[model samples]
Target: MRAEVHAYVADAARLNRQPVLVLDPLTALDCSEAGYAEWFTEVTEGIEAHRALVVLKDKECEAESPRTTMMTVGVRNLRAAAPGAMVFLDATQLARKQDPPGVARTLATWSVKETAGVAINVGEHTPQAVADRYGIELRQTLAVTTGRRDLYVVADSSRGGVASADGCNPSDARIGSYEVLSDNPETTQHLWLTTPGISDGPCGSAPASKPGQFVPELATGLLAGTP
Candidate 1:
């Protein structure tokens, strides 16, 4: 049923020249726990506040729990089938541990580089952290879709349900304010901020996203989700 519905949508989008959004996948379905673990090797650690989307609760040792590369591949397939459709893939924010650790505890990055024509995600705090940590912008990261890598920093200082921190569900300002996530001087605002965002191409140094552009990173996702 899911496949049929997705196919129907893809066909409709292609025929009508409409845009289609796809959420990342969220299931390892056929694979066992161990198999899933192999695919998901990195996750957030030591941080008191975190999001289940980044590191699954109780399943951190394993992958995000119930995930497979096929999920990402499906997005590619959808894009191929719907050439005319504007496919956007929104994935969760993920980071890996660095041996030396830098400005932040965890690296601000995203996974699944290829698939959607554009990628949009509510990165709790990652949107700002990515800029502060790497000294780069979010749109340039691997987080955005492989095609037009554009990231939008529309809001900040909010809690979960829509997009919130994991551990304590801190606001975007708090989570991305410093390295350890306790508190830092980098934060300028404690309230939500909005931006118009770009849609033409990836923002930052490179206009087009290459395979090895940003730190590679996905988990079970919506493939097509609602805001």
Candidate 2:
């Protein structure tokens, strides 16, 4: 599994794309402290070599605060091994037992300044419900071009007005989707914007147009700096 992960990262880096690596420490739990340290060192070195982002899913078990300790160790190791890479904590498990807002705040506070951000899976939960829990507002609607199959536009709401148009016109060949955008533009962030029941899966359905079909022409009219 680890070797597969390394290959995935290397492939993404070779193509000049960023890859996100998700890790669950079930195996690490059984290893001795020294063994765990060595494992983490090797993992961090691999991540540094590939310049990938990591998401650690902190799960609780019988041991007293094992997740908390593992998170601490993981963050410390990453900072030492790969200071340039980003780390995200997926605290969906913890959020199940506690208030989402409180959990989000606590994780943000506990995280190091360099720690990228935190995420909650909210599986089987409505996006609105989760947003309300975090006190996040839906400030804008983005009508991203369905024309570009490979491109997904991610904008920070706090940065304000990612694109010129607020809503899509009837003639537009784009889909209107919403998300909780970040305030900080410098953060490494990605968002998926899809209508309800519209699966963004690769083999789902064919889009009406080809890649760059509408964006180039639309950008000339909408984007400020485009000629």
TM-score of each: 0.31, 0.54
The Cα local distance difference test for each model comes to 0.28, 0.45
Q: How well does model 2 score by local distance difference test?
A: 0.45
User: Candidate 2 at 158: error in angstroms?
Assistant: 24
Over 68-165, each residue of candidate 1 has an lDDT whose tens digit, in order, gives 33333343343344333323223233222222122112222222333221221233334453433332233344332233433222113221123323
Q: List the residue pairs that clash in candidate 2.
A: none
Clashes of each: 18, 0
lDDT of 2 by residue, 143-198 (tens): 11111122111321211223222222112223222343455533223333222222
Model 1 residue 9 distance off true place after TM-score fit, in angstroms: 5.9
